[model samples]
Each structure stands twice: as C-alpha cells, then as structure tokens.
Target chain A: MAKVLMKGNEAFGAAAIKAGCKYFFGYPITPQNEIPEYMSRELPKIGGCFLQAESEIAAINMVYGASGAGVRVMTSSSSPGIALKQEGISYIASCELPCVIINVSRGGPGLGGIQPSQSDYFQNTRGGGNGDYRTPVYAPANLQEVIDMTMDAFDVADQYRIPVIISADGMIGQMMEPIEFKERTGRSLPSKEWAATGTNEEREPNSINSLYIVHEDLEKHNWKLDAKHKLIEENEVQYEMYQMKDAEFVVVAYGTTSRIVKSAIMDMKKEGLNVGLIRPKTLWPYPYKAFDEIPKSTKGILTVEMSTGQMIDDVKIGNNGRFPIHFLGSPGGSVPSPEMIAEKIKNILGGEKK
Target chain B: MKTIFEKTKGLTAKPFHYCPGCTHGIIHRITMEAIEELGMLGKAVGVAPVGCAVFAYEYFNCDSYEAAHGRAPAVATGVKRVHPDSLVFTYQGDGDLAAIGTGEIVQAAHRGEKITTIFVNNAIYGMTGGQMAPTTLIGQKATTAPYGRDEAHAGKPILVSEMMATIPGSAYIERVAVNTPANIRKAKKAIKKAFEIQRDGKGFSMIEVLSTCPTNWGLTPEDSLKWLEENLMPYYKLGVYKTPEGGANNG
Candidate 1:
C-alpha cells in the first residue's frame, strides 16, 4: 500500500477509476471541479472516457446513460449542481442502475456560498431527489476514509443496483491528507444480463429504462427498491463512538465537522470534563442505534455542524427528544472553531458543576 | 421478397406505442437498416429520448437507454466512448432535442462525438397532446398556439439541421421528410449514410426526419402526410446541408 498525500476530491476521482469506472460525465462546479479536471487528464491515459457536460442536469443524465449500459460511471458537483441533478438521480434509482455520485456539499439554500457546510445532510441521505428513495450516503471524516468509502461506494451501488452517494463538504474536498490505497477485491465489471449493452448471439435484446406507465408495475418496482434499502440498513450501518465512559455530554457530528469535534473532545478530556463524540460514517442508515446506546448518565447531546441546525433535527429524532440537545455553528461556509465547541461543553457542564 | 426488411434485425417485433400515422416507425426502420447494412448490429447501441418516443426503449432491440428529455446526445457520448468499438445513435423528437436538450445536442455535435442522431421534427408536440415545440412552424395552430404561432411572440422554428451543419465538428448534416414514397427513400438513404460515416469513425453525423403527427395536427393519416409535404417541407427544406469528404476519422 503506497501512501500519497492527495486532496479529497482528487482522491475520490482516482479511487473511482481504480474501481473500474470507465466513464466520467460531469460539469465544472466549485469545490468539486478538481474531480472532472483530474478525470480529463487521467481517463484518456487509461483508455477510459471523460466528458464535461453543458450543465449538471446533462451531466447526471449522461451518467445515467453510461451506467445503464452496464459500465461503472460517476459525476461530481457542489450543492446547486446537485440540486440540478435531482430529477435524473431519482430516475437512476427508479431504474435500479448502479452508479457513484459525489457531492462536495457547499453552503446553500440557493447558491448560498462555495464554502463547506453539512447543509445537504437531509438531501443526500434521503436521496436528494423527488421520490420515496434513499441513496446510501457515506460521510468520510478524513482523506483515508474518503478513499476507502469512495471505493466502497461502487460496491454498495452495484450490490444494491442503486445509486450510492459520497457526501463530503468543501473542506474535505480541498484539504490534503496522506492515504494508502488498498487493493480492492470484487473489481470485475457487472455482467450484461440486464445492462443495455447490445444483444449479441449470447443473449436477447435487453432494455435499461424507467418509464413504467402502469401504476401497479411502478409500485412493485419501488417496493423492490424499498426492500433493497432495508437490506442495506441491516448490513451496512456503520459509525465510530469515542470516550463515552462516564461522559455527561456527547457531541454528534459527521464528515469534516466530526474531525473538529475530535479536537474538542481531547480538550474537554484534559479539563476534567468527561465528554465524547459519535462520528457517523454512513449518513443514510444514520447510526441512530449507536446514539441510542449512549450511557444513561449522559446529560445532553450537543450537535455541531457547519449549517444552520440542519443535522440537529436528525440528532433530535435519534435521541427521540429524550435529552436536551443544544446546537451551535455558523451557517454557510463558516467552520466552528474547536475552542468555541469546547467552551460550549464547559458552559453546559459548569452550570451543573460536579 | 426479403428487401431491407430482413436487415432490420436490431428492431423488436412489438408494434410501436406511437399514435397511428406517426412517422416514428419509418425513422426506426431506417435506423435498423443502417445498423444492418453497416454490419454493426451486434455492436450498435441506441439512446432513446423522452416525449412521445419515451417508450422507444420497447422497440429498439439493440441495447438501449432512455435518456431524460434532450439528453440523448450526452448519454450517447458516454456510451460510445466507453465502448468505442460500438456504433451509437440517438432518436429524439423536437421538444426533447430542441427545447430542453438544446445545450446537450449542440455540444455533442460541436465536440464531434463519433455518433449518429436521428432527430424527428413533427412541428408540434404529439405525445403531450399538441403543444408548441421549438420546431413548431410559425402560424401553425396547436394546443399552446390556439390562434396560430406568431413569430413575434414566440421565436421562429429552429432550423436544427442547418444550425448544426455550420459546426466544424459535424461531419454530415441533412434534412429529409417521410411524407411520401420518394421522400421516404431519400430519408432512408440519408440516415443510412449518417451511420456509415460513424462506422468509419468519422465525427458527428445527423439526419433530421421531418415526420408527420396525425392526431396532434388534427388531420387524418393521409392529410398529415400531405400537410408535411406542403407546410413543413417549405420551411425545413430537404437535401444534404453538409457532408465530409473521404469519410475519414477525425479523432
């Protein structure tokens, strides 16, 4: 395993190529443009394909086409571009085509900012498109997880025959970190039993489409997707919990924000304040069960994010409003300092000083 | 007795979902014949567009993908590039290719992707129950343009073949009609040649088939063909607009 320092977005693109993704269709979007730029240079050398679509909608549709053809394909973009891709993404899921989609989420309700934010938490985990579909979301806290999770993204997508999203923020996209590329197994391209590859003497004509007019037939297809999602939840829910022994306050965060929470946890430990963090690795089958396992002695949960209280809602749902949850963060591209988070922990503990 | 019918191996046996008298059938046969004559039937993949032809996936027996409105070209680029040995083409209606997917189609041709496109221009939306399309003739009456199309209000019909012909990346561009037996023969030849160009790895090639939509035009099957001859052909003139010499692979 050779170690190399690489930016998260670039690493994500390289991992996809290594995983046998032969087509890269995308447009240049901030915080994630490096993915396409990297693909443009690398894909041709490997005898793969790369295209810069006119817009995000076009890009995602191209990905849908390539994926439907029984080849590994992917696209990357920021928040606004991702929003443009929602219609196509929903159709991809409906058709049960396997593909990898990366969203280097930036601050936004509407073209909000190009800075890092966890504002897309609900959007990514909940499928980020029209429909009752869910895309398995991977939230990587560092560069290594970015590489590992991205490679896993293809496996999960193909395993479930559904779209899998790697949800990172602008900070992770831009930051450089050392990562060791792991030798991956199960790297063979999916067979063409259902793919839109031409029907040769080996098989009859196969169509990859999503236009089911009959309500009952459409309903049955959606139900199949639901069952696949249930299977994913049963087998793939993953998270990392830290230093929870006798802790009264638990910090919950994900992606880059979770890394910041780690610094805060260390500071809180030295000050004789018992605090811990629960960093989620998978955002879709969100580690709610892990949060539920928090010690009974814990007083409350502090949810930190780079958005305006978006993920806190999920935290509240997981805790079932069983504890007093406090939210703190700067919305739209502002990263909350470790000091501020640690101070908030001290303040919460000081009032009920032991 | 067999004629070219035996050559259409890539097409399915199922009757098209298009309305009666619609010329999508003619265009489909032409594409199938092209694949057969080029000896690329086993290596060809067709991209089907949305709209009246949204169910086109059911008819093209070759491996096919249904693209969102106006995105067939972009998707074709991905599929063709990934499997460079395969012959790729897209079949789209005016609304799907001209209005919503204008950006994708233009760029695909501009980049000279090694693919063929069969653009069907019926002058009005058929599947969505008669609406104004980008190629809807000026002064033509439809569901959206009840009082006849007004060039001042909604721009003139887009001359798609002519517009794409000017691009340097485009190796061949032609407009044809399926309104009559003679025109149908010419249309078939043009479409077959477009596929031939791509088989040679020549850049982008396109054939716009000016088709008839009887139900949408409020005319009987016979009148729809007559209307296409009289009204549509006058504006979307027939014949080849551009053709590359030697049919050499540019890339």
Candidate 2:
C-alpha cells in the first residue's frame, strides 16, 4: 500500500482492522475520540463491530467478553477513562484474556488537561488495577510506528494470552503524519482453546474466570502468571540504539520523547558533543539490556520523559548504580523541544562545548 | 426403572456453595434446565456476575465468562455480538444488576442486543454479608440499613422488571418468583421464554426472579419462603410486563 497522510488515531483504527480485529469497544475521551469515531464510521463497512460503551468500565468489560470468546478485540481511552477501566483491565488480566488496549494519555491526576502527557507510565506498566499482574506496554513514537505496533499488538497479546497496551500520548493521537501499513502474514498464535466460545460437546465447557477462593489455589495461579511475566521480560525486550559508537553520554527515552531526543542528539552533534539514544520500544519488559551495552566512553545517562520522571526509576534500576542518571522532563502536557533537551545535556556536562 | 429425575447435563458436577434456604441454587437449576431443555447446552455462553453467584461459571455446563461486578450485561453484549447464533445470557443478582450495574443493564436493553438476562433479585447482598441492595424492600433490615431501610434516607427499592419493561428494545420482560412450587414452575417457564426470544433473535429478554436470601434475611428457609410469598409477591407482582406483540419490534 502507498503511504498516506493519516492522523495517528485513525491509523491505529485502520491498522487494527487490517490485523483482522473485528470488534472494538471504547468510550470517547479526548485526545483519543478520533479512534472510536473512525472505528464507528469504518468498522461496519468491513463487517466489523464498533460499539461506544456506556462508560469506560463497560468498554473494557466488553473487550474482556469479546476476547474471552477468542475474537480479536481492542479498546482505547484517555487517562481518567483508563482509570475507570482499571478494574475491568485487572479482571481481563486475571482471566488471561488477549486484547489490545490503547491509551492516548492526556494530562492527569484529575482530568488535568486535554493535551499530550506520559503521566500514565506507572499506571500502564506497573499493573494499574489491583492484583499482581503486568501488561506488556508498547510505546510508539511516530504514526508509522503506531500503525505497525497496533497491528503487532494483537499477535503479541495472543502469543502470551495477555493484554498489550499501546501507550501513546495526545500528540501522537492528534497529529497527522504520512504512514504505510505493511501486510502481516504467517504469524503463529496460540490456540484460544480455552476461550469461552460455545462448547461443541467435543470438549468440556470452557470457563474464563479469575476467582480462586482457596489461598493455595490462588498462589498457584499467581505463580503461573509470574512465570509468564518472567518469560515476556526475557524474550520481548525491544529497544533502538542510535549512534552509540564512541559516545560519551547516552540519552534514555521512549515514545514521543525519543523523537525529540533524536533531534537533540543531532543538534548536539553539530556542536561536537557526541550523545546517543536508547529508545525502549517495550515499556513493561523494559529494554533493561540496552543499559548494559552502554559504551565505555559514556559518562552519564540522561532520562527524558513527558512526565516528571516516571520512567527514571526503571532507568536507574537498569543502570545498576554504576553511573549518575540525570532527568529532564516537562510535566503536565508540556513538550520539551530539541533545543531544551540539548541545553539540558550541555548543562549536565558542565556547559562543556565539546 | 425410569431415570426421570436425574441431574440435567446443563449443570456441572460441582455442588452449590450457596447458603441453605437461599434461592440462588433454585434459580441456577431452573436457568440451566431452560438451557438443557432448549438443547443449547453446547451452544450457550453464560456471563456470571459478581455476587453470590460469582462462581456461576463453574456451575453452568457451558462456555462461561465471569464478569466484573455490575458489568455482566456489557460483557454479554460483547459475546452475543460476536456469536450471534449462540445462546448468550447474563446471570446477575440485585447488587450486581439493579444497583451498581443499572446503567449497563439499561443500555444493553436499549441496544436490543439479542441476549437474555436472568436477574435474581434477593433484596440484599448475600455474599458481602447482607448489605443493603438497591432492591431491598422498604423497612428491610440490612447491615448497612441496620435501623431498617429508611425510605426518606435510602429511597425506595428499584423495580428492575418494571423499568426494563418500559424499554421498547426488550422483547420479553417478566417478573417471577420461586417461593412456591407453582411459582417455581412459572419461573422456569419465564426463563424458557426469555431464552426462546433470544434464540429467535427477537431482542433483549429479561426475567427478574424474585428470590430469597434466608441467611441474610435472618429467617429460616421456610420462613423466608413465607416472607417472599407475603411481602415480595405483593410488591413485585408476578406477571409478564412486556411481550413481543406489545412493543419489542416497534423500537
């Protein structure tokens, strides 16, 4: 397919459909309303189902239901809406249902603002709802990456029978960019033999549930889930290393922040400062291994984020206390420009021009 | 020797964990019997709500999804939309349905999703240790309403069947009881009709079964039945509230 200029949210909807997702349930919340609107207008034409739920609580449960039936399903929302969906997401996680959830996060803490923010970093990767469960978080930086990751999310969710969250901010959701969706083929997914589809008497009735009354039984279930989380962490750590050869400083960032950091690296390069970037593509099974590959010439790691240093904790953990970690962030819907980031690096390096 | 009263294959071998004299077991049996009689045992998908019947997925011998509290209707809507040919139903109690899940049930009915809902209204939260529910009768004593359900403070009980009947998308709406053998038979028939309406793809169908929570009500099993007969049946009159010929297809 030829590249077309598409808004990020619309591309997400189209990508999901192309990935054979026939069901979408969501409640409209800003910075992400375009997703549901596009789905409503386009889904029916492709023999897909798009339902605007009564609330975010209802929307995630609807995703649970469809996914429990072994169908490809997805839901998208903003911050407060995602908060409302936490209970159902927890249930979906507990039931081990495979579905894709997109969070085009806006400023938060209480309906803060309808602008781009990565404030939901803790809520997405660290089990937003109750219980000991983790969702594989993918942070996409551009429209094309959003399209590609949105398509891959379904297969990744099914591969592990777990929910995958595409954590994009308002800028990625609202901005328009040229993108092309590549056709996905020959992906092998686990058989949803455990889904609550109708039993044909050839098999026992399937039950998709999370309730375990006995402590021992619940412990067993939790251990099984923990094992899966460990496997995902080991196999699904994805990151991009740009220009690390003989670099003195490494910038750690993801999503839209990484794009800005890339520009900052280019600007810093013009001034004889050599800085590289390690962009984590998967946020939950965070690319901790990338930190181990930091060049010997690296002096410090600079963490850039849209929020006030949410992902820095993981960066510190990955750095293993070997190097000083500097943080530069513009919280509450403020986007740090390339010049601002470049200046922060220069300041951290003692205003050294070289 | 004829095997006339054997257990229905619609239910699993799991024994009921319900309290003695509680009507949840009876409701579950009749609901499953309806599935068995309709030959939908293999083609049925049940959504279990959060309440005493949270483990209803284990008891029903069909593909089941245990839904979060008060979200069974929305879950059932998803299942029915995905598998239109399958028999899909939501089994919810008052706390899970009439109270926290009111919006979900109302919207599901409004959408006229081809699914059935077996609403078990026992008037109190049984699993949560007898808390006051939205369907708790006036003057009904509950943990939350220790002084009795004060109408001035807590408001009157919500009549879910009556409210659901008012929705044009609902194809069949009936309020039944299981206090007596005759009423139990009537409840079974109402359940069967609700499933039949769904099978016909008529629209949303619901049967509100007036049930009892003897343990929560602080009454014996027998007294609970008498209380239901004397108090509940009078307040929640037993009859069909809406029929397909009345307003189901009109919407």
Best by TM-score: 2
TM-score of chain A of each: 0.95, 0.97
- B12-127: candidate 2 lDDT, tens digit per residue: 99999999998888899999999999988889999999999999999999999888889999999888878888999999999999989999999999999899999999899999
> Which consecutive 10 residues in model 1 chain B have the weakest lDDT in total?
B242-251
- Scored by TM against the true chain B, the candidates give 0.94, 0.97
Model 1, which residues run further than 4 Å from truth? A183-192, A350-354, B1-7, B246-251
- Model 2 CAPRI quality: high
**lDDT for B153 (candidate 2):** 100
TM-score of the second chain in candidate 2? 0.97
Model 1 TM-score, all chains together: 0.95
For residues A1-354, write the lDDT of model 2, one tens digit per residue: 899999999989999998889899999889999999999998899888999998999899889889998899999999899999999989988899899999999987897999899889998898669999999999999999999899889988999999999999989998899999777674788788898779976689999899999999999999999999999999888889998988889999898889999999998898999999999999999988898899999988899998898999999999998878888888878899999998888888895432
The local distance difference test score of each candidate is 0.86, 0.91
TM-score of each: 0.95, 0.97
Highest-DockQ candidate? 2
